[model samples]
Target: MSLRLHRIQRFVLSVLLFSSLVCVSCKSSEKITREVDPTVEAYSIDEDKAIDRLSEAIQHKTVSLEDTTEIVYDQYDDFIAFLEKRYPHLHQKVEKQRIGKYSVLYKWEGNESNLKPAMLIGHYDVVPVSSGSDTLWTYSPYKGAVDEGFVWGRGTLDDKSGIMSIMEAGEYLAEQNFNPDRTIYVALHHDEEVGGVRGAQRIAEHLQDKGVELAYLVDEGLPIAEEIIENVEVPLAMIGIASKGSVNIELAYNQDGGHSSMPPRSSVIGTLSNAVNRIERKPMKASYRGLIVETFDPLIPYMTYTQRLAFNNTWLFRRIIKNKLSNNPATNAALRTTAAKTIFEAGFKENVLPVEGRVIINFRIHPNDTVEDVVEYVRDRIRNDRINIQVLDRARNSSPVSSTKAMPYKMLKRTIEESFGEVLVSPSLFIAASDARHFHDLTSNIYRFRPIRARHEDRSRIHGIDERISTENYIEMIRFQIRLIENGAAEL
Candidate 1:
């Protein structure tokens, strides 16, 4: 009988141990789910009127030129007046102030004075359509043609849509007399394409002088990326929590001039060319760290079985994962700093051996590295005492990485889920710079998101030929802005 009791006890203990192991495995791989609002209503707009307003705004030709003198100030004035005429209610209801000659700031007061305000920012500047690419476009670059369900133009996708959606949301709220418990600030910067020094920077200083602390700031950035990952087919909404830095380094080699017929064994051009080739061949080391790792963590659960196995066991598959990510240009950029040689100057005539040769390389720095780090890496790779390096412009460091656990982030996530059902949301790093980078001093909660559906095919259209946005997508953008404003300002 004692032997029988021992057998039964052993069976029970084995079962309990098996159950505990299963529970632990389940807990380790659990997927996070958010509670979403099922009946969140979409905001309505006058479709024809909205499209007409956008078309008119695009026709104004408020293009940002590298040389400020080239910009037509009259066009900017006309665009501002057009905004006032189109959205009279917003102008009358909100206190408007012009900063830095052209940037517009609108303040909407709330009942609660103690609550910090929320900010919505967008830039109106559009990159110039390259001189020779006009023939490639299906529609006129500045005509703002609304055809076959797309509003086609230079500013359509780059950003005029972003600012217009914000204005439409504000006009809707103001017309309905919707009062909030927190203040709201709308900043429309005019010079973002050219670095935003005069527009966004001045706005930040003006707000700082007034002693204002923001609850959150939202700017134009990552869209609802469709089929972004290799094995993940679902649409993913990427919110940019930080941005990379930028630096321009000029590498120059100077030697005594000589006739091409009597060139030295290594001329200035030859040495500089060799340095460029070496730097390109030996790039900065790419690693899976910082925001890139954070971005991939939540995606594991949704990946295909093979992908899931590979991602879940990163210790064993680290090399495989890095190799796969490095093969693609987009993913490769997410992995490390990238170098591009943009400008190169040598002898004006082929028969002359120039005394000086220069190459300007631009680097988009990863958050893990700094300007000094990039400079050191380049110098080490070149290893040529003859090459003199000069930093041509002010180098910017990586912006502070905002926390994913903050209340503003939570609110932003919930609003996105509520607006677009059953989509995966992830915190990502913005590869490009935006106006929000200037507001790092005011708040730690800066989010970069634009609620437009973007796919791989639409990649080249941005700042390229055939730039456009679908009319339906524009409506969705308006709905998203309205939801964000309503939910983001609600009392916690």
Candidate 2:
């Protein structure tokens, strides 16, 4: 009986040891965030004057229309003139050139000519309010009303705020005689809303032709997400290290037309519907590993106990985590390539069966996948010799992931800490496309971050109606830009 009791004790001890080990592993995670002293001093600006500048800029109807013929070129010109009138110091300090149709590039020469330059990118163009949606806004969409402690308008958030902030910072720096060891280039695209084909692309080519390789480039993108992730209430400063590639695949089916009474079993509409259904049903595989792991590592420390355990012990809970993440549209997009069927057209009349049906599927390619991979994905999924598949124009491969260890990334991280004080910083995959995609070959250290403090509901306001930026957030953006410019143009 004593021996039996001894055996029970041994078994109990073993079970306890195993449980303790499991607990330890569940809490283990490599914290990659390094606490560092800020490199730039806190700078103050005239808040009212700064807000006025952005508000006035937003008042301009520099809307980007799909058909360039529909655009009012005068508004674009007025915007350029407004910059000259407002930022006299910047105009005097830098050499400005017009590229593409309306894009502007400013070159601020540095003391050290040998050092590679840093580029600050932004787009002045804003998306147009949908027809009959104007009444939905509390303030006029184009009025640039400074009410409710926010700059109420179309461009305030989706990026006149970015343009105005950079210009404000650059003008202030130039006025302060803050000469840098490296050159600074400010490239503002006019048509980023449509695709930046004319604006950013032209500037990139012009820079490439001049053999202008940059040390780094910063553009507008992911922001300081406040309460975006559940259970992690702390704000996350997510820098877009890379943007997903975008391609619109057109799938068309052509067949003989027939009357509605004698519908064929395999009509063009049915064939096209089947193809789209198949593509929608089988989305590209979700990738919870690699960069995504790196993206969420910094936030793991801020998660609740259960959340932390699940994230930390992904080996045992990967499927559970994946299911949870996949359930949400936003998180799901981050983990995988997304195929959205944006346009589907079949019969034009009620009684006539359409001879042709066309479906356009726009896929945002994952960082791991390529444009070719997506095309092959669609082709294989459709598996129909009769259907025609063609890739539309403006198709681009995903930007190569920039290194988090790079000096530019680190400097930007330091700048964020200096500007926002306490915040979680991480490099994330930008699910949406941005003007930064145009500069992939120009620099390896391209980071897309706008530094705007955003909540979950604030997202729809970007291109949607009632777009606005809080007065406080706008001021912080200016300060952030100032620090970013000074830090970026400083010595390595």
Cα RMSD to native, each candidate? 8.4, 6.2
Model 2 clash pairs are none
**CA lDDT scores, all candidates in order:** 0.85, 0.86
Q: Point out the worst 10-residue segment of candidate 2 by lDDT.
A: 27-36
Query: Which runs of model 2 end up more than 4 angstroms from their true locations?
Result: 1-42
Score candidate 1 by lDDT: 0.85
Question: Compared with the true structure, what per-residue lDDT tens digits does model 1 show for residues 239-297?
Answer: 99998899999999999997889878988888999999999888888887667777777
lDDT by residue (tens digit), candidate 2, 1-492: 867755764565465457656665543343435443344334658889999988899899999999999999999999999999999998999999999869999999999988999999999999999999999999999889998899999999888999899999988888998887899999989999998989999999999999999999999988888766675677788988988888999999899998999988889888999998898788888878987788788788776555676688776567667878888777788898899999999999999999998999999988778889998988899999899999999788788889999999999988998887657888999988888888878889999897899888988898998899999988888888888887888887
lDDT of prediction 2? 0.86
